[model samples]
Target: MALTPPAWRHTLTEVPRGAAGVLRLAGKWRAMATGPRGRGEPVMVLPGLFNSDRSNVALRRHLTRMGYRVEGWGLGRNLGQRAIGQDGERLFARIDAMAERYGAPISLVGISLGGLMARIAAHRMPGHVAQVVTISSPFAGPPDATRVWRAYQALSGARIDDPEVRALVGEAGRPLSVPTTAIWSASDGLVGGAICRGEDCAAVEVRSSHVWVQFNPDVLRAVAVALAT
Candidate 1:
């Protein structure tokens, strides 16, 4: 079972704390110092809700330097359900196209809501997706566990408590056919880390703020290692 959701205090203080974390990116740069090259395989990076591919730019750059062919989701800004409506067939088609382009399975690294989407894609198309890595994504609990649920509902026009939404979230939490890794943070200011885990995937814990998790150097290194394997 997933752990209890974090209290409102943590969620409320997220932005300033996360900004501080973002400012510390320079330190992470110094720490990571060098990049370890990968097998030059195809990797796709998906951004979180309300964010576009731009959010994964830093992570993508790091992966590219590591000799991996990383690309963004390309379906425009992630306005949650609004991007693909409810069915998500369009997103699936995009994943299929990326797989066909390389003629090989693709590894996915997604942040926040993107991670859940990646998990769903992997579950649906194991042949196309070789591995999955999620950073600060809530896969094990209700959507309401996230402090940003209101924003999601406002932007996506989907109610979190809806039975269909709950069912879908539950399905994404199940084991996936591909190798999976979930990178979570106890200090996450937005969604609680407890809900970011999956039973089938190995879980790696990090110290990062929610907004900065994608850009944090440690998280980047973890993602690189997952991609390499």
Candidate 2:
């Protein structure tokens, strides 16, 4: 028999909280400069599934104020397999160009599905990527464990269980030569907390919903700490 679906009550609560977080970002935009900064090394921020670079505006602004040269993947919207395009040649090319521009390996900070992309990129070209940090990314469970699976299918027209998707999902648990940090949240509405923890990843926990994690103060602090390491 199929198991009963988990309660998504918390997920529903995220709607208002996410909106509030966006407002908080607008008010505190300038204060971001007061925090600790990075080495001005290149940091590329990738958005979650169905998200465009616009969703990461607050994150990029904070990171930029922290003295890091950060850029978003210019790709319009993240479309699962389609975003990678033709064996991920387009994505790889982006990584390669960043590394070349900086004259050193680049750090990647990805949210949700974007996190999975970062991990794969790091593994594929460890020489180009310095480290990877994933926020609210499910690394220890199947794709179905995520609340967005159905929405993902609806938006991308790709089966969550397809062979290629399965292979990419499996890569989440595999360790990479470059440093990796998985920042998860117990309050995440979309992804279960347990599945976000990966055996091969250095884990950090935050108290925020999956949607607002990108703008959560604690999450921002953790991302900085991860990149500074």
Which candidate's lDDT is highest? 1
Candidate 1 all-Cα RMSD: 1.9
For candidate 1, lDDT tens digit of each residue in 1-229?
A: 5455577677677777777666777667656646566877999998998888888888898888888888999888787754444658888888899889999999989899899889888888889999999999998788877777888888777888877667668777988988999999888877888899877889999888887678777788889888777
How far off is residue 177 in model 2, in Å?
1.7
- For all candidates in order, the CA lDDT equals 0.83, 0.81
How well is each residue in 20-111 modelled by candidate 2, as lDDT tens digits? Answer: 76677667656655656687989999999889999888788778878899999888799887866344888889999999998999999999
TM-score of candidate 2 against the unseen true structure: 0.91
Worst 10 residues of 1 by lDDT: 79-88
Model 1 ranges off by over 4 Å: 1-3, 30-35, 83-87
TM-score per prediction, in order, is 0.92, 0.91
